[model samples]
Target: MVLQRMGSVKVASATLVAALAVVFALTLMKGTYSFGGFWSTEAHRNRSIDLQLFDAWSNPTLWYAPWLDAVGNVALFIPFGFLLVTIVAGRWRIPIVFSTLLGFLVSVGIEVAQYVYAIGYTDVDDVVCNTVGAFLGACFARILGYRGRGFVVTLFLVGALCVLAEMVLSVVF
Candidate 1:
């Protein structure tokens, strides 16, 4: 019975992982130049992060409409890492270091696609943010068992709490 349960989990995980990989691959391959209706113009370069249009990072408040952009980027890749740890084979559970590498590879691939297909620029900031988001997702799986309902959901909530807590910390302490 125990073995059968594990086998089911393995199968389910594998299927989920395969599906995620395919979606990710296709998304990366397809270059949509008019994504978000905001990235259409290349004139946002003058909006500096440090000096000109700074937001209260400590507050976790949205700086312009870009807060949605950041959240969107972070939320987009959560499933990749989740699928990695959950469905990957026994010896192939994605390690943190490997996850980071995967993030970098994905970021690179996206940037390359954008450049080759004339969709987006090769921004270093995007790479850093993406890698961080992926890691957070993978770390969620690692700390939690990665397969199951109760604990996995708890992990996701806790992870969000941590991110929120960080912002709260910035303000409180």
Candidate 2:
């Protein structure tokens, strides 16, 4: 009974950590809401500026030089993937289907938030890429968790790495 209780607590903690990570990312990028949640719009530059992927992809300059830009965008949402896995599987044990759906919701939420806010724009590619990023991170966490890893620890570590990386990008680039 004690062990079961401890496990449950760990799972809950893991999910909370992931949620907080997402909030933190939002806070750092954009000036959030009046009530204190990380405002996704804080990261937006223009209200409805469309970053069409086809246009971006067509540019040869973006192909190799902006690796950091791509990483920054994708890494920004790893926590969502991490959190979805933790929530559905209880310790990073989520199945592919569950991860996919949750990833989709999160990506959609982000895109919608961007559309609503005057700063950010709604882009389908952002949604697709963000979901893919989260999915990859979740898969990594799930694999490690199978060997008795604690989801909470994974959550904290992943969040920390992302935070640090973003800081570097913001400072240097």
**Number of clashes found in candidate 2:** 5
lDDT of 1 by residue, 1-173 (tens): 44234434554464445444433432342232223344433533222223222233445434554566556556655655554555442566446656667866886687566555554344555666677777776676677663452344334434544544443454354
lDDT tens per residue, model 2, 62-137: 3653454456556655655654554567434436557667667866776666566554556666666766777775
Residue pairs in candidate 2 whose N, alpha carbon or C atoms collide under 3 angstroms: 30-42, 30-43, 31-42, 32-39, 47-118
What TM-score, computed on C-alpha atoms, does each candidate reach? Answer: 0.54, 0.60
List, in order, the clash count of every candidate structure. Answer: 0, 5
Which candidate's TM-score is highest? 2
Worst 10 residues of 1 by lDDT: 45-54
lDDT at 135, model 1: 78
Report lDDT per candidate. 0.51, 0.54
